[model samples]
Target: MISSIIRTMITEFNNDVDKLSNDLTAQSRNHVITPREANR
Candidate 1:
């Protein structure tokens, strides 16, 4: 049971990271972040 719970948590964390990466990629593709802001 503990192992299953840990696996589930890891899967959720991975999914969250993937989603955040996708969001950042989309924002970058849209040119939403300025170069100066990025440098900061």
Candidate 2:
């Protein structure tokens, strides 16, 4: 049960990260962020 709970948490974290990356990509399209800037 503990392992299952951990897995669920990790999955949710991954989904959130993907979503944030997509949002960042959209914002970058409108604005300008150097590759190095985004990398940092």
Candidate 3:
């Protein structure tokens, strides 16, 4: 039972990390694009 609980916690943590990285990537991409758009 303890091992199963630990496994579940790890899975959730990995998911949160994945989501955070995805958000950061998207924001960075937008920042890169926005500057060029403003200059144009």
- Report the number of the highest-lDDT candidate: 2
- Tens-digit per-residue lDDT, 1-40, candidate 3: 9999999999999999889766666766778445444434
> For residue 25, what is the lDDT in candidate 1?
68
State the lDDT of candidate 2 residue by residue for 9-38, as single tens digits. 999999999898777777677677654555
Would you list the clashing residue pairs of candidate 2? none
Those runs of model 3 whose alpha carbons end farther than 4 Å from true positions after fitting are: 32-40
The residue pairs in collision within model 3 are none
Cα lDDT of model 2 overall?
0.80
Mind giving the per-residue lDDT tens digits that candidate 1 earns over 1-40?
Answer: 9999999999999999889777776776779975445444
Index of the highest-TM-score prediction: 1
Off by over 4 Å in 1: 34-40
Better of 1 and 3 by TM-score: 1
Local distance difference test, each candidate: 0.79, 0.80, 0.75
Residue 31, candidate 3: how far off, in angstroms? 0.7
Please count the clashing residue pairs in each candidate, in the order shown.
0, 0, 0
TM-score of each: 0.79, 0.78, 0.76
